[model samples]
Target: MSYEFITLKQEGRVLTISLNRPPTNPLNGVFGQELFKAFSEAEQMEDITVVIITSALEKAFIAGADIKEMAAQDAAEAEQFSKLLQGANNILNRMKKIVIAAINGHALGGGCELALACDYRLMTSGKALIGLPEAGLGIIPGAGGTQRLPRLVGLSKALDILLRGRTMSPQEALAIGLVDKLIEPENFQAEVMQFAQELAAGAGKALGYIKAAVYEGIDFPLEQALAVERKYSAENSKTHDAKEGLTAFVEKRRPEFKNE
Candidate 1:
C-alpha cells in the first residue's frame, strides 16, 4: 500500500491523502496506479470514516496531466492510461466513506476531474484556480470529467467550460457551485481537517447509507430512487448508532456512535 507519488496520513477516523509530486502534481500512469492502491487500502481500514484529498505543494494542487508522458503515448497506451485514471476516479466516487477535496491551489484538466469525484470540495482563497481545460490541448478530458462535471455544474455551464477550456478563479468557482467552501490560505489545512474530523465523528453506518442512497439513487427513476432511499433508511434504523442517536436526542445529550 506504499505510494511513491502520494502520501497517506491517518489520525483518528480520518485519512488524508496528499499528492506528493512537487512543483505540480501532474497525473500520470504511475500517479493513477498509486491513487488506486491508496484508495483500496483506505477502503480496508476499519477506523477510516472520512478521506481528505489534497496536495503537498502550495502553488498548484495539480496543474494537469503530465503532458510529456501523454505526448509519448501511442493510441493504445493513451486508452489504457485513460482507463487507469477512470478506475481511480471510480474508486473515489464509489467509496462509502465521505471524501472531501481540499483544493489548495490550481486544479486543471485531470486534477479538476479528480476533485469532482469527491463528495465535497473545499478550496483555498486567493488566486487558486480550478477547471477542466483539456479542449485547448486538442483533446477532451479522458477521465470522468466529461460526465461528472456536467452532473455537478449542469450541462450548459459544463459545456462552456469544456469548449472554451476555461479555468475559474476560486471565487468564480464557488459562485458556480464547483466548490463548497472557500477558506483563507492561512487556515486552509487546519479547517479542512477539522471539518473532515467532524464528519468522521458522526454516525458512520448512517453516513455510509446516506452516501449510498444519494449516489446510487441519482441514476434511478423517481420511484426506484425513493425505494432505494427507503431500503437504506430501514437498514440504518436497525443499527446501534441509530438507536443511540434517537435515545440521545430524547435525553438531550450528544450520542457517541460506535459505527456499529
Candidate 2:
C-alpha cells in the first residue's frame, strides 16, 4: 500500500521506512497510524529480516510531535492522540525482526522516544541533538519517553533532560547509552545499512528472542530475568538456524544462517 507520510522500500532482506515529511518530520495522528500500518506489513513479510527506520531529509530525523495538531485537541482528542502514538510505538517495540533507528539528524520529543523504541540506534555524527522537551511546553511526554529514557540513560540523567528540556549532543547521547553507535555524516547511510545487513544475515528468530530477553528481562528481578532468558534461549534452540550453527561449530566451519 502507498503511504503519504512515509516511504517503505524493501531491499533484499532489509526493509527501509523513511520519514518523508521534510524539515521537521512531525508525527501526527495519521502519520503515526500509517507508520504502524507500514511496520505491521513489514513484520509479516518473511523476506524482511531487518527494518531500518530513517528520515528522507538530511536536516532532521524528526523535529518532534506535531504541536499544531496537539493544540487543536481537547481531553478526549488528547486521549485519542496518545493512543495513536502509543500504538505505533508498541508495534516497533514488540517487532520480532531487527529494527534499527538510523538517526541522520536531530530527533526531538516523540522522535527521541521513537528512536528509543528501536532494538538498536545508529546516529549520524554532527550537530544532531536528541531529547524529550515536552515538559518545557507544560506537558509531560505522552509517549514512552518517561519510562524508556530513564531505563536507557539512568534516572538522574533522564530527569535532568526531561526537567531541563535540553537536548543532548550525539557524543553526550553516546556516553549515556542513548545511542549504540555513531557514523560520520558522510558515511551514515552506508554504515547503517552495513550494520542492518549484518543483522539480516543472522538467525531472525534467535535475534528477536535475544533482543526481547535483553530489553524486557532487564526490568525483572535477577532470578526472574534469568528464567526469562532461559525460556527464550530454549525456544530459540529449536530453530533450524540453531541446529545449523551447532553443526557448523562441530565441523569448525562458518555457518550460513537461513534466518529461520
Candidate 3:
C-alpha cells in the first residue's frame, strides 16, 4: 500500500517501513494516520515475520512531534492529535511481528517514543541522539514514552532523563538500555538489513507468541504471568513450525521453518 508520509518495502519475510516525510519527520495527524495504516497492514501480513521501522531522511529517524501544529491546537484538537499518536504507538506494542527500530539518526520526543514501542532498537553511531525531550518543551510525553521508558530502564533513571529532557548518543543510550545495539554509521543500513533478515529466518508464529507472552505477562503477577506463558506455549505447540522443529530434532537435523 502507498502512503503519503511513509514507504513500505518487502523482501522475503521482512517488511521495512521507512518514515518518508522529509527533513525532520514530525509526528502529526496525517503522519500518525499513515503510521497507523502501515503498521496495521504489517500486523496482518502472513508472509512478513519481521518489521523494521526506519528513516529515509539522511539525518533523522524522527525529530519530534509537530510543535507548530501543537502550538495552534485548541483543547479538542490537542486531544484528537494525542489520541491518534497514542493509537499508533499502541499498535507497535501490540503487533505480533518482531518489530525493530533502525534508528539511523536523531530520535527525540515522539520519535523516541516510537522507537521504544519497537521490540528492539539498533542506532547508528555518531551524532544520532535518542530520548524524550518533552519536558524541556514545556510539556510531557503523551505517547508511550512516559510509560515504556521506565519499564525498560528503572523508574529512577527514567525520571532523571525525562525531567531533564536529556538526549544521549547511541553508546550512552545503549549503556542505559535505551537502544539494544549500535552500528557504525557508515554500515548502518547493511547491518540493519542483515539483522532483520536473521530474525526473519526464525519461526514467525513462535517469534510472535514469545513477544506476546513477555509483553502480556510482564504486567501480571508471577502465577498469572506463568498462565500467560502457558497460554501462548500451548497455542504455539499447534503450529506447523513447532511440528517441524520437533520432528527435525528427532531426525537430528535443522528445522526448515516456512512460517506456515
How many clashes in each structure? 0, 0, 0
Please rank every candidate by TM-score, starting with the best: 3, 1, 2
Give me the runs in candidate 2 sitting further than 4 Å from their true place: none
Q: Model 1, which residues run further than 4 Å from truth?
A: none
TM-score of each: 0.97, 0.95, 0.98
What is the per-residue lDDT of model 2 for residues 51-83, given as tens digits with 9 covering 90 to 100?
999999877998798898899999998888888
Q: Clashes in candidate 3: how many?
A: 0
Candidate 2 clashes between residue pairs 3 or more apart in a chain or in different chains = none
In model 2, state the lDDT of residue 249.
96
Q: For model 3, how does the per-residue alpha-carbon lDDT over 1-260 read when each residue is reduced to its tens digit?
A: 78898888999999999998888899888999999999999988999999999999999999998899899999899888878888988888888889999999899999999999999999998987899999898888887888999999999999999999999888899999999999998899999999999999999899999999999999999999999999999999999999999999999999999887
> Can you list the residue pairs that collide in candidate 3?
none
Full-model lDDT, candidate 1: 0.91
Decoy 3 TM-score against native = 0.98
Off by over 4 Å in 3: none
TM-score of 2: 0.95
Q: On residues 78-115, what C-alpha lDDT tens digit does candidate 1 reach at each position? A: 99999998888888877788999999999999989889
